[model samples]
Target: MMRRKSWQKNLKIAVAALLIIYAVEHILTMNVYLRKPMLFSPLFRVYNQSGSEPHCPSVRLSTRVLPQIALASYPGSGNTWVRHLLQQMTGIATGSIYNDEQLRHNGFPGESLSNGSVVAVKTHNHYAGKDYARAILLIRNPYESMLSLFKLANSNHTGEPSVDRYGKQWGTFTEERIRGYIPLFASWIKLQDVLPIFYDALKQNLTRELVRIKAFLGQSGIKGDVRCALRDSEGHFHRKETGITLEFFYSKKQRMAVNSVIDQMQKMFKDRFENIREDMDTWKL
Candidate 1:
């Protein structure tokens, strides 16, 4: 009985020892895997060919040989049209448009590209408080933007549900539906209320808007014809062959109110132009 009891005790100790060893081995393996660098393989290939590791500053400089301008605007504000025009003016290919995939690979903010001599990014997000170093804010008639948005919502080609169905499903039914047709419409409804407030602030100070843009670009030591860079003279406001038609559904008073709001926003930006220029001059590259 004593011998059998001793054997049982020894068996339990051995099992525990085996389990501890297995756990330790598993942890070490996982740790090594986690430590492996993500871009190491690509970096190694470049270094092997060049006989030196490329520095990040050099990469940034190369990407910024020409200023990297982002086309910042609200949705339905002719962003796509502006992108195409810029591509033509700069002689960059459409296939080389900066996007999130290239941005991630190049470590650029907001999935922008680095292939063009002058890189321009486009986005609709609000300015990064004061963190952005370069940006261009594009303003359009708010009424037109809303009209375009409504048409886009009503269409099926853009992979959105019909506006009539969208409105009913989401609540707040109008004779027309414009909900699922636009991306993230539910969230946008909340934003729409606040947009007029910000728009008024912006319109009241256009000069400030320009100055803020210049300051952001100046941080990269990029100084050029800022006016020409922002010009949209190519008459490429609409997509080619998309057959999208915009119809105004708002009453005259409502339309006028929208225009009035936009006008105020534009005027605000205009008033702050000098201040913006002064701010740009002070930013360090």
Candidate 2:
């Protein structure tokens, strides 16, 4: 009888605590659903209510008073993750030119980076735009980056494949693909002011990178919680389980293929690729 009474008390406490949390969520997003109807789900709702979302908040953060900044990278290089991190940090919308229709589901609409006087333009093109002041180049491990791209491409239902699905499987890479990657990898050098962000370094130590990034962007004093930033960057990903990377997902043959490609890249790019491979500590995941 005493145990039963204790159980009832715990249940009541749990119910009260849940109610309090729900009330808070509702208040934050109650009327917001109409304005930003995408602000449904009381659980993950956050809004500035007055402003539009951005396509690439970090890239377009105008270092100058005029013109836009380009956020350039090859697809699957964690550019989307960077966009999400920026959103959580600044409550600004981070969007993609290609995926605007889908970005809205995550609170970043098609016009997230539009309608603003100053914008951050994001592109996968290997070239720079004439109108931009400068660019921020984001990089990632080729094997994992290719895997991410493979999964993304295979998932696209549009029959045409998304982001140019490179090969038949996760681990199997190509000479042609590697050749394409070399140019994209090398393209960062063209920008007058390029801020190179490596994915492996970022996932391992985001707070440190973010500090560096904010300072590079001339907004070093921007106030935000490190815990929250980490949570947003780590959790906001649709494929956060870490199973899809080269470490586990790729087969022996696939790994061999990746190694050959890496060797080729290392021979060609030298320290640019090798240094990152050495720093490729993925323990944070």
Candidate 3:
């Protein structure tokens, strides 16, 4: 009888402890839900409360059929930031060809193959065998873009790199990255339905550029709250300016080499922007 009583008491204590934990968790979840309704919202479906402006628009998969459009850019050319802006403006999640775990966990739930469900798929590769019906080519100055990539690589894709991190390896890295631009731009330039968006232009006028993008995507029907999107324009992955200077990435010799490549890229764009008469096979990748 004594052992039975002890066993019953322990079982009761364990049951009570579980109940307490459940209650605490429920309370906490409720608190979060009340404070930020967007936090608990689902990613694959739109959620809009009646007669109230949403705190943050819920990102959803495309409800209507859409073309497979790519948001193409070199790494560190503000691709993630542009996706954030578009997500806010459209309430549709963007996709990516490469699945980035960090991006999937963060805002981009659609981090897979470029498909109709996503508004636009992000990509860095524009070589042969990589083709899309339409593309938004995001261009940033080579120097800043390459430096940004270096920082991202060093800091695990979210932070700036330390000055001490710069060394001999960076020089080689810089050369390789700068060379990559030629083929990337060349491939995209051949596309008939491509929108070339400069990074600086977007910074200067976001709303105007968004309007252009919306028209191009044939999404003028959906009324996106531009003001709300603009409220937090700088998205999660944007690395702010830091004290670490990036001048050491290139020496005078390296600068000349980089500039020569830049000149060739400009010549290609200028010569073939309207007419892609030049044979693509001849261009060295």
Candidate 4:
């Protein structure tokens, strides 16, 4: 009789503790539902207020369809940043063919290479799903882009910089990245299947570039709230302040090195180079 009483007391205590936890969690969830109404209200309504089917799922109608355009960029050219902007502005996610673990850690959604509902897909690979109408090629001057990439390779080395066929070392890694991409850029530009977007434009005037991105993606209704985008992106870990700047990255030696590489590519891809002829110097850099 004494043991039975003790067991009953312990069971009651456990039940009370569980009830307290459930109540606290309910309150917190309600707070979130109130604060972020756009994100949570609809789902909450479906689950809480639906008559017979309290567990009915919220139906989401996609605003855009995919097999969509690629937001293509070489590494360190702010590819992940632009993808975040799109995700925030539209609530549609960005994807990559490679499904890099690094990209996901930065808040990208799951692997979405074939997800047609995705708004924009990131790709560094040349020939992945070329049937997309056009690509938003995010270009940063190689001086900054390569330098940023080199710094990344050193601090948190990934296979990104070492993927060259010839096994180029860090001294020549930047040059090889530029040389390899010049021909690819020329070909894509010549085919007119790419809209070249300079990374500087996005940084300097976010709203203007946001408008361009919306126009390119054919979704101008969402306003592309630049202030909101900036606020939201401020907390992401991958976006740590790097102290890298355009003026800092710009150097005569870097310019001359890239120019030599571009010159070599230009000889072989003459007609193709004509596509972005005006921006070639910046591209050369």
Candidate 5:
């Protein structure tokens, strides 16, 4: 009888513990799903939202106004926005390797065709086209870029991931992307006549960056206005701002490893572009 009672008592305790655990878990889940904001909320209001400027006319290149220039950037590095700005400034449609149906219907009629039909083609691959002679390489902070990639992967271009998805995937996804940056930068650096544009700097000064791009493209006779492009700088691709916290998501060891790689890249850029003092500032957080 004593042994039986003891076993029964233990069973009772186990059941009570499980019930408590279930209750706590349910409450936490409710708090997350019902009360808390998303983990991947927009962390900064970097772009302007107002602009009634007529949609920039998208036209096919008749005589190859610019050389075979690739507008190169990693996924989620604001390539679409840059393309929009380029169209606004140059009045010529930008082409891309992947023909996104949404982009095609929305504004990018030059989607999927990287020939002379477009001024500069968009490419995410390291191995750009053999015919490509020059490129405008757009670079963004790895942290921000990774977050944007995660959102794009989990949701749409401008949407946030579910809290549960973020909890399960964000850490691993971020670490992998952070590591992937090394080889991406390494390969692209080899391509000759590459102009590196920092995304943050572009956000800070839209018109200035567009002017720089205009001069780089060497198409002075284009019928697009660089100053007018600034009025609608934040095109349809920019995600809505939800918050403004730039926290480091990696652990100490991982942070050190990523920083070491970034330091090497910054040094490489310094060697490549002598006037990169402002661009070097992008390495900071």
Candidate 6:
């Protein structure tokens, strides 16, 4: 009996060792493949529908025209509003604004096709370690953004449990579960902690910002008035107000915490506050 027990312990140790080796090998292989540039080709191909040609119009537009204009925002900081504005300005709407599944699959509809012009893609993901020629980062007060996100995620029949699906699967949109996902939603959330990082980096340099934006837009040889574009886009969301107060679903303490988060965020992105100021200054109503 003593001999049998000893043999069983040895077998378990060997099995554990084999499992560890298998896991390490699998991880190494994945790391190697992920590090390869060719891996993104399939992803780009699916977006462009052009097989293996980097110079295809769609591919060229993606790489050159826009360079990279990731409309980075929390879950609902008016991304749809921005996307619609961009679409109207570009004169290409494949009717994708209303389709969530399509947006999830194709990234964004307006820019996915070979329009041969600058494309504006909306994403909830973080910057993927690529140098973007121009990027428009739209941020909202975190409390408002988070609350809006939670509400949106919970509303749809198709939506999964927020903590379980996004939290566990991708580890995003919350602090506790950001590690497993790419771009880690938690990092974005922590943007509230150091709002100054974003403001100082992006806002203080407006001329440089405009130059980068123009450079990206010029890649498609497209030129138009951005002010006019903003007007056209803003008109779409115009609705008659019924004087209804939008109530917060969170308790007073929760609301206060969210407000605090927004206050910190505002300080960080204070430079861009002028854009909002300019809008308010010109407000006719």
Deviating ranges (above 4 Å) for candidate 5? 1-66, 219-224, 279-285
For candidate 2, write residues 1-285 as lDDT tens digits. 999999999999999999999998897565545332122233442323354332223322333242355667777777767766655554444434465555556455433453233334567877644655566678776766665666566763122244344335332444345557767756655555666777766755566676656665554233333334444464344564443344555556555655665565455444443244334323212
Please report the candidate that would top lDDT against the real structure.
3
**Candidate 6 ranges with C-alpha deviation above 4 Å:** 1-65, 92-99, 102-108, 111-118, 156-222, 225-247, 271-285
Model 2 stretches astray by more than 4 angstroms: 1-67, 110-119, 156-176, 219-228, 240-285
lDDT of 3 by residue, 15-133 (tens): 99999999978986776465421222222233345745556668888887667788999998999998988788778889999888999999888888578888888999974545477
Better of 3 and 4 by TM-score: 3
Q: Which residue pairs come into collision in candidate 6?
A: 195-268
Per-model TM-score versus the true fold? 0.39, 0.58, 0.71, 0.58, 0.73, 0.44
Task: Tell me how candidate 3 scores on lDDT.
Answer: 0.74
Candidate 5 TM-score, C-alpha based: 0.73
Model 3 root-mean-square deviation: 15.1
Off by over 4 Å in 4: 1-64, 127-129, 157-168, 191-193, 219-255, 261-285
lDDT to native, each model: 0.41, 0.55, 0.74, 0.59, 0.73, 0.42
Give per-residue CA lDDT, model 4, range 76-191, as digits (tens): 77777777777765566666777577666556654455456566677766644355666788877666667667757655423323334223365477657766666555545544
> lDDT tens string, model 5, 131-193?
677888898876677778888899887887777875647778866777778677677778877
Q: Cα RMSDs of all predictions?
A: 22.3, 10.3, 15.1, 14.0, 17.6, 22.5
Which ranking of candidates, highest TM-score first?
Answer: 5, 3, 4, 2, 6, 1
Q: Which structure is stronger by lDDT: 4 or 6?
A: 4
After TM-score superposition, what is the CA distance of residue 203 in candidate 3 from its true location, in Å?
1.2
